[model samples]
Target: IGLGVIKNVTLKSGEVNGLKISEGKLAGFIRIRDSGKAELTAIGKFVNSKFFHHLRNSLILATLTVFLTLLFVVPAAYAFSRLKFFGREHILYFYLMFTQVAGGLGIAGLIALYGMLVKLGLYNKLPALAIIYAAGSVPFNTWLLKSYIDSISPDFDEAALVDGASYLQIIRYVLLPMALPGIATVAVMSFIGGWTEFILASLLLTEENQPLSVWIYTLMGGIGRGIDWNYFAAAALLFALPVFIMFMLAQNYIRSGLTVGGLKE
Candidate 1:
């Protein structure tokens, strides 16, 4: 009878007057809830929200962070790799130190950063978030790209210069082409920083502007219990899909970068 009751929606209503039982829509909902159907329904809603609302700001952040990182990091990395300017090593030491410091800031720093954003009227602005992402990524991306460029002999730069090419021209026509893998690596990392960020995204965006990270975090409210596992699962899956696909497409470039850039570090 429970099997039939499972099919019928009336089993949701327990014994009436301690005797009668009617399976109805309530029973159907419960049955469906536990069976993943309800979760799938929630997933659809989550995907729709992601595409319609979050995708806009999230894409904006990703694109700007990548573009700005490439713009600034290429020159900085080139100089670091090829120039013998004073304090260059000291600058790198400071960058590495800053990386350690930033990593240890934890939640307190995140909240403080967000508070300052509000004070500066930057809260809830996607462009502001992009700026932060780009700036924060600088120390790491610069170091990474610099190391990659260094692995290539300075002879490459000299070759271009001997050809009457300007510094900018050499960077544009020579160094950048050779460092394509490293650039792609930095771009992907910057994109991830913008896309998967949760704490900052949550604090910086309004309800209508929240991204997949916030959606996945806030959907169930509590962990392990008092939560709808299906909805959370579905949201998590959707949240990860785009990044996953991109990673697959980028896997080759990433490998080349790590192979070239990894040994230098």
Candidate 2:
């Protein structure tokens, strides 16, 4: 019987008789059906079966993205903070302005640009997201790091220079250790931003590679007949826990980094 083939199935008022079952018979019929189908239906309603895989994939990709952002951001932050160069201020300002104007949605144009690059064989890839995330973080991280760098006494760099240390040596040996607290601050911020970033990742990544934020949004009454709330909450809580832990651990460094440059005489 159709009823035996389907388990835990809910029929509307009209469809009950088409399967030759009255409303009263439907419940008993569903209860006697295969246990596997019943379990599947329950799981589907409870856990958003459509997006469960996407959610898992997003968490993995977001973690990688956070790591990648940190790897690039630290060195770039160091350069912007300590190195004197032509057009430095202009570059900083330009990035600042761009960040201000362009939000998650603003990157749609960039996504199109990426598509064009992809047609030239460069689309829907991890490297593309990495490049965008790194570039996007540069201005803010540069300013943040510059402030921290300014807080460090130039005497340290001067002392290192007197010892015939090259610029690379100075950064590695002298500045980097002193800048650890600030670096920690940048690392936390950049990682969280990338983890929560939805639009660009959603736009740039294919369905198989979509981030958690995008995956969550997929459950909201669009892809299926109804929205699944219980699953959405579970997934959201899982996505948020890491960010919460990261913030709590880095709170002290963030406070110190922010306050270090203030109160100059």
Candidate 3:
């Protein structure tokens, strides 16, 4: 049923009693809540209460994170797949793997990271936050893209080289087209990571720059204030919508990329 149609319907006494059943409890709750309005709820108290700003902040951060990740990962993965440098495998397997594993240091590492950002004067900056997101994404994305690139026959690279294409040209004209599925997979993962991340965002960002993830927390109100379930529900749904749509659109590519990338190595 449409929300507007449901909103206009008046429940009879018997229907209201029937709605008290477990199966109808969720509908009951939604029905009892008022629209998020300034006069009616605490959600309207904050001057920055407009969700558009939070959504725009998230989009900017997520887009920058995806761009930075692809810029660094694509070239690095191509090098790892094509080059014969000394310690290439060792560096890829050991150093890159270590970076991924070290991320588990969690709060301890975040503390140090916070200190460094403060010293660098990048605290609360969106671009800097995107950089951090990109850095964390690099190791795994490089490995994934490299594995996908390795699956592509080196004959393509050799043919491009013989046709007078430089490595950059080959990457742009040759590998990238063939490896698009992998790249899309990486982009989607990076976007979701930046979009839904809460802890780091909560710590690094202030109110004016808060993303939807952190903004939801502020909607919960401070101590001694009654929680507004309706406002929280609305904000949470809005926060989830983009990620849901992206995943639905990209699930096929994600599945194929992961499957094909794993096949070679």
TM-score of each: 0.73, 0.69, 0.75
lDDT of 3 at 73: 95
Per-residue lDDT tens digits of candidate 3, residues 1-265? 2232123223222333222323332332223335432121223222224588889999999999999999999999999999999988788877566666765865669888889889999999999999989988888889988998988989888888887999999899887777878888888889998998888998888889989888888878888977868667877887889888777767776566444322122
In order, what is each prediction's RMSD in angstroms? 8.3, 8.8, 9.4
How close to the true structure is residue 58 of candidate 1, measured as C-alpha lDDT? 68
Candidate 3 residue spans exceeding 4 A from truth: 1-48, 248-265
Better of 1 and 3 by TM-score: 3
For model 1, what is the alpha-carbon lDDT of residue 65?
81
Score residue 113 of candidate 1 by CA lDDT: 87
Candidate that scores best on TM-score: 3
lDDT (C-alpha) at residue 169 in model 1: 97
True lDDT of residue 29, candidate 2:
39
Query: Model 1 reaches what TM-score against the true structure?
Result: 0.73
CA lDDT of every candidate: 0.71, 0.64, 0.76
* lDDT per residue (tens digit) for residues 133-203 in model 2: 76677667767877878878877777778879998798787766677677777777776777788867777
